[model samples]
Target: MNLKFYTFAKNIVKIVLSPAFRVKTIGKENFPKDGGVLICANHIENLDPPIVGITCPRDIHFMAKEEIFHLPVLKDILPRVNAFPVKRGMSDREALRTGLSLLKEGKVLGLFPEGTRSKSGELGEGLAGAGFFALRTEAKIVPCAIIGPYKLFRPLKVIYGNPIDFTEYRAKKISADEATKIIMDEIRALLSAGK
Candidate 1:
């Protein structure tokens, strides 16, 4: 998406959603202003990505679900806001390449480690693909906690934790699941913070 369009779209959506949802955000400074960074969070609802994106003053190249792309209006609107589709279950090399490309260009990539929305609003185990990105790239990984089911006119919170340092994990012989677990644990901690 072009910078001009993104800025306009972002501002318009923020204006509408912020007040309507009463979205509360903490740890906005957790996001690095310069260079590439990965924003990893638990999936609460389809709106989680936009909530996180607008809350943090950064342009996020979100790895969105493929099903949403099938939606007529959203399919077009989401990409305009820097969102790309990802086939959830199996590996989608195209999505991975797009994420890598965005990272290489020193852009922020937003993704959900859980790979799908949590129906019960509970945290669950993460998929290894999120770990794979963190382990392979030098980009910082920010664990974000999204609380609430994002009902209209309801309270929704997006709490961001400090970036997880994975330099050691990248150097070690850690399995994908182990690496995923390591990342997910931080997100879990963020969810439990100040509780």
Candidate 2:
């Protein structure tokens, strides 16, 4: 990942967003200082990624939708900012491989397990992709919740929960769907507490 660009972009985002919205973060101590980590959050608005990225203590490598990468300026800027394209609505093996590779390199990956943004701002069902990654690698899974509406000047909070260890589940050889449920349940709890 481009550390310099990521830092620059993160700083810019903080400056731009801090005044426009009432942003707050909790449970920052839960974030691991080193090693591969998976940050699974609820997809609310398009700005969710940046909000999470700025609040996070570590740099995040986000898996954005493939369509956004084809856009005019974002196409060139996305990768430089540590954002990668992921083909949604299907099993894109290449994208999966890229995510796996990043985890193997001890990078932090930001994923919205619901696949797409919730129009009504409610959390959606978690997909198997995140579970697949968590099961395949020894990455610490951190359940995050981006709470509150996107309205200007509204109080928006991003809460990071404790890291989830899947060693027993992995040893038990649980299905991806089952693992996803466990992850989603933790996210649901965080969202509830945030509210």
Candidate 3:
């Protein structure tokens, strides 16, 4: 359950499972090594988080939905792997607190800015949660996208985009909804660029 050991285990899972799914990645260098970086990625597969986490050089804590947290074995393992539950459609305050706390601790936090996986493989509008967290915490926002409605043996590519500083937006007192839209637009651009 230790952070290091959990990371090691997750890496092993990625190695063994990824090849079966043919997951590939590009733009890995965009991931920041230190500090509170908010990695806002589009969800493609259940494998998305582990793929990003294992590929990223830093240990990242992800915000998972509450349902996953209640699962017996997953509950035990996910927290160890640095994932905490966010009650969907409910109070996002807990998620914000946990995310900001991790950033304050100089760690990376992973989130799905789109909120849910796109069953159509098309990008969705950004959720205000991701932007609010980044703006309030002053964490750098790293736009990310995963291409491919990944299937067994199908090729997948996870793209990490450049960091977006929210300082100017913060200075302007931009609304979280507006900030999220901007952040997601950046992510959409990166996703398109990769293709």
Highest TM-score among the candidates is held by which one?
2
Instruction: Give the clashing pairs for model 1.
Output: none
* Alpha-carbon runs more than 4 Å astray in model 3: none
Clashes of 3: 0
What's the best-to-worst order under lDDT?
2, 1, 3
How would you encode candidate 2's per-residue C-alpha lDDT over 74-153 as one tens digit per residue?
Answer: 99989998889989889999899999999999999999999998988888899999899999999999999999788899
Instruction: Predict model 2's lDDT versus the native.
Output: 0.93
* Candidate 1 local lDDT, 104-123, one digit each (tens): 78899988888888988888
Give the better candidate number (1 or 3) by lDDT: 1
Native-to-model Cα distance after best TM-score fit, residue 5 in candidate 1, in Å: 1.5
Clashes of each: 0, 0, 0
Order the candidates by TM-score, highest first — what do you get? 2, 3, 1
Model 2 ranges with Cα > 4 A deviation: none
